[model samples]
Target: MGGLSSEENASSKSTSILLQIVEHSDGSVSRPFVPISAPSDDRPDATVLSKDVPLNPTHNTWLRIYRPSVLPLATKLPVVIYFHGGGFVVFSAASTFYHGLCEAMTGAISALVVSLEYRLAPEHRLPAAYEDAVETVLWIQSQARDPAAGEPWLVRHGDFSRCFLMGSSSGANMAYHAGLLATALELLPLQLLGLILHQPYFGGVERTPSEIRSEDDPILPLQANDTLWRLALPKGAERDHEFCNPVVAVPPELRHLPRCLVKGCEGDPLVDRQREFVRMLEREGASVVARVDQGGFHSVELLDPIRADSLFSEVRRFICNDL
Candidate 1:
């Protein structure tokens, strides 16, 4: 809850210099650059099946599935359906860095990981992304029930009985809403475990202390966030509208839906809001685990490869423990 002071800010400035040096070092060049390839229907290991499958008729909505190689030998694993962060305006599942992260998560948790590719904004507009997310989950559930009906992807890797919803940033927003909708309609299968939100963008009526303090964050500027929310929500509606704010959107009846693992970054502007939402969830007696990392920025977990391993480790542990 403490804000970074002037002295801490100065230290961060110095750290940035060292970061630049390390980024440019020869050792960094030797690291493999992950390529963002289209989700394919292929098995990397005898027991593991990985594939890209379309979720919608338009074929615009799709997801990449990764099932662990040791699945059959191990206990029935939990499934994590993940949505990537992109400010709801940019990025795709083909992003090499994120794809690699998903690949790593599959190995880390030994669970099935589905990286959802939902529609982006300014083109698809508000609600389209959320609708796509809801449909994708439903489609995934159906596929799990009858693998034959789905593409070769699910037939090879999906285990629907242990399913959870997860996302980062705007994608996190979608996952949050999808969970709410599932609870509201009682449509979600009993296997739907919980939710994991990483630096979710939940716009509110007022700025939190972190938002005001980190208005000038190097990675995610507050103004940019304001802009993204303005474009992502329904036209002319308040940013804190029930749909935009999960804390408000979640109904009392849906309170018992599932456990949630909320991750936040100390240096991110949305940290305070994220914390506030977690507090609200806990107050409602929901099973919640909030992990706030120090000296981290928005999307830092994905942007920094050096940190990705640690981040993935924590996430994998959460998934395994909660499942």
Candidate 2:
């Protein structure tokens, strides 16, 4: 949650040094800023009991399930399939920051949360993550058909009929693409209720006003954003690739998507793109609710407890009541 140090801040104004990368001899790179895997918490007093399982063992893709510690008396809870944000390169389902965020979401929304750990970039780029997302949904659909076929927690407590796709940052991008696939293919019996995109990561060749102004942003500097996208998209693809910029080619499924919740922040460099996305969805006659906060940067919910709680409250309303 800490911002740039005084010295780093001074240096950042002159030259952005965020996300210092370390290249490995194995043709992979690393960002040494955030450590990985904080371990799943299943403490008795915890609001939710979490466990990880392989969604597709063959691909090293896995997911973490967050079930409410205290189940309701009669009703099965809504199912929220989530993707973590790491610019499509870093982080995992078990990462400390995302685990806490999902746990909070499970409690606040009173739903079953499944956080996906898709393969990262500089290794398994673009369509790989998008494919994993669709696979995740298919796996859930299989589990719903026969409770004994998959994870017992979901089989017992989840309401596949009231499902949602939610994510933050780059993860939100994955959710959007996957949502389109799900709607187009009509992955039935596993009803998709809505989409929740929190500061969706999108880019284009043109420099957005927010992006230009956030040159020295401590969390995500301009250089880091460009580098991540370069490593994520196809070998020669530009920022305007359909995967990076949703506005490039609006899919027919765009209007058919379920209700959507698009949340953006004024302080985020990608805020302009988020706003543009909302406008597009509205023009398509899609049911969309746009919330643009006057302050806060990208992934502010991750750093601020109050903001996180407020976000969860909004999500709870969106899922449990608003929709």
Candidate 3:
């Protein structure tokens, strides 16, 4: 296996590894509530707050906040509104994977991180997750303005003027569209720092040469990618919805939208599509930095802490450079 070709190695490893990781977790902790750890000098301080703010009062949507601990007397830290991956159907704030990543991000960027637990599909479906994302942003803005909310980190540490939208995989798709909708509505008051898209899945198009080439990549197989997208998109709708696929849906006028840091895996099926997105963003006059890590698979950073730190280092540099 060590001497095998990249495609052969990936195909053999993807299923067994994914099954082992996802199956054993079952997403349940033994306690009803677990105390979050404080950020140390070595690790960013983080805490989880659960709130019942409604997305649609009728529909009754809410979100949980994963706020990184702030430096004492620190003012106006950057804010990262993050969405978790998991193909839009599995995983939640409870996952150790999410908790650790959010903490690391807080420490790396010195930003107040807001992780949205949006409703998933096929129960929620298509525009639902996107809508929730928009609402979450609006809610953050509202909370920031309210003095009665009394100086929470979002208001204290958050610099609404310097907000960064970030997401991994399916969450990246949501973040991309939410930014578009924000630009369209003229509701984006913050200085759009940049977008951090990690292994973004833009949906299966007519399979790019890379997709065909890496068909059996270890982390994300072709069939699994197709199945996740099918569940995420609208019933009978084309995969190229303006909300789903930024390459087609993104408008020419919105070209100067924001800076972008697109991270892709050489072994992942979505590598080509991510590269295409980076090209489109660059063409639109937006500053873009695209990095393709050799021999990496989809969300490999999340699965391995060492890799996650390397990825986070790049993200920190991007955020701090702008700050």
After superposition on all CA atoms, what RMSD does each candidate show versus the true structure?
7.8, 4.4, 6.5
Give the per-residue lDDT digits (tens) of candidate 2, residues 92-180: 78778898888888888899999999988989989899999999999899888777776788888899899999999999999999999
Order of candidate numbers by TM-score, starting with the best: 2, 1, 3
For candidate 1, lDDT tens digit of each residue in 22-116?
A: 11332121112335765534545434446777788584788787776555653455778888876676667767767777877778767778888
Greater lDDT among 2 and 3 belongs to: 2
lDDT of each model, Cα atoms only? Answer: 0.70, 0.85, 0.67
Superposed model 3: Cα runs more than 4 Å off = 1-60, 186-189
lDDT of 1 at 123: 64
Model 1 TM-score (2 dp): 0.80
TM-score of structure candidate 2: 0.92
On the 0 to 100 scale, the lDDT of residue 233 in model 1 is 68
- Whole-model alpha-carbon lDDT for candidate 3: 0.67
The digit string of per-residue lDDT tens for model 3 on 1-323 reads 11223454435434523223221254321222223432332333224332323345655555444455436474667778888887776666445677678867676656677777787776677788888888877777776667477336566656778787899988888788777767765444456667888888785456676666544556666555555566667777766766556777568646655777888878777888898888888777887888898877777877777778877888888887742
Candidate 1's C-alpha runs over 4 A off are 1-36, 40-49, 69-71, 152-156, 186-190, 248-250
Model 1 score (lDDT): 0.70
How many residue pairs collide in each prediction? 1, 0, 2
**TM of each candidate vs. truth:** 0.80, 0.92, 0.79
Count backbone clashes in candidate 2: 0
- Specify the highest-lDDT model's number: 2
